[model samples]
Target: MSEDFKKRITVAQADYTKSFIQNVFLQRTIFFLVFLILWQILSSLGIYPKFLLPSPIEVLETMFFGFIESDYLFAILESFRRVLLGYILAVFVGIFCGLAIARYKILDNTIGASLTALQSIPSVAWVPLALLWFGISEAAVLFIVVLEAFIPSALGVRTGVHTIPKEIIRAAQALGARSIDLYIRVIFPSIIPQLISSLRLSWAFAWRALIAGELFVNGVGIGQKLELGRSLADMSQVMSMIIIIAILGYVTDDLFFRTIEKKVQKIWGFNK
Candidate 1:
């Protein structure tokens, strides 16, 4: 093909790709708006009692005014604080356990099997034990969050370690890399993509655990607000809290974890 024709084809393909992406985004936006309109119409028609199912506008209003008039802002900050602290601790513990389990076959067979089983149990299942041990304190909440998050993180690291090419390890060893050097320079870097995925999973687990813990334990948190709304039969407040939680989860995953994953994948040549 002539250079001019080739260039034209390339430009056409680019335009088509861009248009397709825009169309998809537009469709999604339209679908969401339509859903909200339908919800509003149903609420207005009184198909469901307002107490049971508040309109989107009501929920939005509650969410907006909540930060100003109520303790919603403090609740959000409190939840974030707990989750962040728990997630940070979980990452460190998980990585350490993962490295240990990966390095030792005996520990892998024993602890790894146990972790697999433990992971199947719901995070809330541990809440009772946490309550018994820590007695409705922040420690109880942190304990649940750490346990929920660390298992996935540890498992992810183990899988990542196992996936690493033996040749790379051998090369590092031959180059006088040992112990901490091997981990810092070779193992850790090699498993970054998997680590990012693990961290994302851990964050999700931690968030859920934090909420569950807060629901049971006495605290000023989003979960507490949700419980209070339920107690008061305030559907608007409940919906607002639910929406806020969903938004926070989506925002964190999209803005932080996914962004980091993409960049890491690109660096590792896993993305084109």
Candidate 2:
């Protein structure tokens, strides 16, 4: 093809791609708007009591006023703090355990097997044990969060390690790479994409565990606020907290973990 013709084709393809993306976004926005309108109409028609099924506008208002007039802001901050601390600890523990399990046959047969079984348990199932061990304190919540988050992370890392090309390890060994050096230079870099995915999964688990813990533990937290709303028969407040939680989860995944995952995949040539 001529240079001019090739350039036109390239531009046309780029424009088409951009238009497709924009259209998808626009369709989503329209769908969301339609959903909200239907929700409002149903609530207005009294299909359910206002206190039981608050409209979107009422929820939005509650979210606004709750932040301004209530302890919602403090609750959110407390929840975020607990989740962050727990998630960080889980990442460290998970990575260490994962590496050990992957490296040692004994650990692989023991702890790795145990983790696989433990992963089947729901985060909330650990709440009673946590309460007994820590007496409904922050420690109890952190414990649950860490336990819930670490399992998937450790498993993901173990799987990643197993999937690593044996040739790379042999190449590194031939180059005089030792234990720590091999891990730092070869193993870790090779597992970046998997690590990122594991971290994201762990964060989600941590988030759920944190909320479950907070619902039972004593403290200011989003989960506590949600419980409070339920107790007080305030549907608007409950919906508001739900929306806030959803927004935080979505933003965190999209902006941080997803962004990092994409970059790492590109760097590792897993994506183009």
- lDDT per model, in order? 0.94, 0.92
The stretch of ten residues in a row with the least summed lDDT in candidate 2 is: 20-29
Runs off by more than 4 Å, candidate 1: 1-22
lDDT of 1 at 224: 90
The C-alpha RMSD in Å for every predicted model, in order, reads: 4.0, 4.3
The stretch of ten residues in a row with the least summed lDDT in candidate 1 is: 20-29
TM-score of the candidate numbered 2?
A: 0.91
lDDT of 2 by residue, 156-235 (tens): 89999999999999999999998999999999888879989999999999999998999987779999988898899998
Over 122-184, each residue of candidate 1 has an lDDT whose tens digit, in order, gives 989999999999998999999999999999899999999999999999999999999899999
lDDT agreement of model 1 with the native: 0.94
Q: Candidate 1, TM-score vs. the true structure?
A: 0.91
